[model samples]
Target: MKTYFALIFSLFIAATAFAQNDTTQKIVEGRKNSPDQEKKPYVILISADGFRYDYAEKYKATHLLALSSSGVSASSMIPSYPSVTFPNHYTLVTGLYPSHTGLVNNSFFDRNLKESYSMGNKTKVADPKWYGGTPLWVLAEQQHLLAASFYWVASEAPIKDTRPTYYYIYNDKISIHNRIEAVVAWLKLPAESRPHFITFYLPQVDHAGHLYGPDAPETEKQVHFVDSAVYELTKAVTTTGLNVNYVFVSDHGMTKIDREHTISKPAAIDTSKFIVSGDDILVQLYAKDRKDIQETYQQLKKEAVDYKVYLKENMPTNLHYGTSDDWHNRIGDILLIPNWPKVFNMYGRKQLNPGTHGFDPYAVMDMHATFYAWGPAFKSHLKIPEFQNVNIYPLITAILGLNYTEKIDGTKQLAQEVLK
Candidate 1:
């Protein structure tokens, strides 16, 4: 009898020790989610670049559509002015307008650095140092949470002491499969170190759309490619038995433009009079000689019959551009916006080939973007009436429980709409 009793007590003690250790591990790893975490809340922000909302429905992305049918969905998302990828992505992460985030264009003169910064140059890319605002990933790290990014806006750039725990260098050529692989690798890490926040970017949809129109069959197929990748990623994450959340978003919608639709300065103006900055819909004209401002302005105005020409002081206030000192100097003295299909690039002898963005965001062809949410954290079967790309930042920060108090131009939060 005594021996049997001893064995039973020993087993009980061992089981208690194991349970205690498990609880301690959960706390140490920061995975001890609250009672409210039953939804298996985790976030995966996926960027499909120039995907349009209607295509998402028309093509019947069963997986993505299920997310909308089960969780919150939006008919369309509005993009900020000069809606290029860099600016729009920055806005998504920082909750700031292009002017506030200092990414007004993909390629712009950084007066402070006395050098031009562009999306192509990794060295000159925007970072926490140059950005006046904080990205959600930085905030996540500050809160002792592990954040990983496969490929996201400015993820490669070193931010003030806060870098994603894991990140891949931004590559325009990286296939959808590789991006999914990288994300799965990070999630499969030791449970204690698994990322609490993850961001994945698929550039093919946007890349192909820029070369073709967003509605082109090629672009639609590209969207399907990304959709397939997302479906696979979701399955992988769920199989790991970790609670996760997913967000599908695009930087901006796309528009079709060709050479026949292009406009430029009349042949009479001296070609060498100004430095030409290439923005498809918006033209930035820098005077080669400051003394010619008045004459150049008059000449540009005379030829600007097809587009809207605005002096720096008289620029549209609603566009949320041109008011800041940094923006004023970086932008040309005169800004020109073209009508749809009608676009403009710096008019030199060089032949311009290809479609582009950086147009007004409210045009009939430009107003709508795409957004979708899935997993347990989102509000089920809800539709958000109106939202912007900048609203994404607040949603990310809130989901990660990061402490950020900076005043971003975009303060709206989608948590209530997306979270049950």
Candidate 2:
């Protein structure tokens, strides 16, 4: 009985240790970089979620400023409309607009599947059928190039029936030192087995922004943390004696919201008639019956005071959203977009976060994200004008010499401008 109790205690301790620092690497075996792929240069595609275009300047992120100044920097990279996390992160990898990729918002309902997807729902996030477009990792793996992801939006899913050759399920359990060490280890592998394309993500800045407003010193501290972390990762990579390119981007920017006077559900729309999805910045109404869309839209428009209401059909074409652009039909029928700074609190049941995103990136400049690239694959001391985020797909593919035939929205113009 004492031995059995000891075994139980040991199991509990083992589980606790695993929970603290989950360094489990998921690998797809029986994959190798071809001779041609092995010759290709390396790319460490990094996304700093919610790192705005100006944060490095505003916060004096020394490492990032110096690193990007040496290579290529964008004035601002325009996130696709409803500039939010899940959608834009997925957009960065797939090079498709949220409408085209079917990840319309961080949380949205799919009328056809009679299901919904949310960033918090691990099951929905991991299911491959919900994703659309050929992600860059998939594009690389399909062409016999090995790829890896430290953490990415859909990297956990078997999208296109192919996961990255090496990846980690999204988690914050690992320390920055461990993450940097992992990247260095991946690079140090034999040429044929090493990943030519790697992805890394940092959520520190975004988390700080959301918790403490963008202008807070607390947020600035996180900015510096990311700055130091990236510098460390790159510094570690230098030890491997391999040329590893890096493109640092963000899913979207952050903005302080008016949390005091949050918008409430309009009395004009009956909850029984429509299913609600979305949050403070964007509110989407999915009609229970097809007949409810028009009436609900008209009523919401009449009642909307601080927000704009539009039928999915009438949404601005520039957003690349609406009836015509709804490739997967995941977009809401009646959409409500709160004007800048105003956010919905639904029934006023809960207080709101001081900072938020998911606004129109063009209309609200605060929603624009960052883009910085460096290493042997890119031009030096070059700064480009603001470009749409979709163009990033072609840029990385161009760097890694990965050919993609899919007619994605991103063009090769940025690649031609930035690469050697």
| Best candidate, lDDT | 2
Q: After superposition, how far is residue 272 of candidate 1 from its true place, in Å?
A: 5.9
In terms of TM-score, how similar is model 1 to the real structure?
Answer: 0.83
List per-prediction Cα lDDT, in the order shown.
Answer: 0.70, 0.91
TM-score of 2: 0.95
Instruction: Name the runs in model 1 displaced over 4 angstroms.
Output: 1-41, 126-129, 172-175, 266-273, 287-291, 324-329, 345-355
Best by TM-score: 2
Q: Which residue pairs collide in model 2, if any?
A: none
Candidate 2 lDDT tens digits, 1-420: 999999999997886566435669999999999998889999998999999999999999999999999999999999998799988988998899999999999999999999999988766788998899999999999999999999999998999899999999888888889988998999999998999899999999999999899999999999999999999998999999998899999989999999888888889767799899998888898899989787777777778899999988999999999999999999988888999998988867676779989999889999999999999988999999999999999999888888888879989899999999
lDDT of 1 by residue, 182-282 (tens): 67776677654667788888777777777666666777788788778888988877767776778888888776666665675554345487655546666
Give candidate 2 misplaced runs (Cα > 4 Å). Answer: 1-22
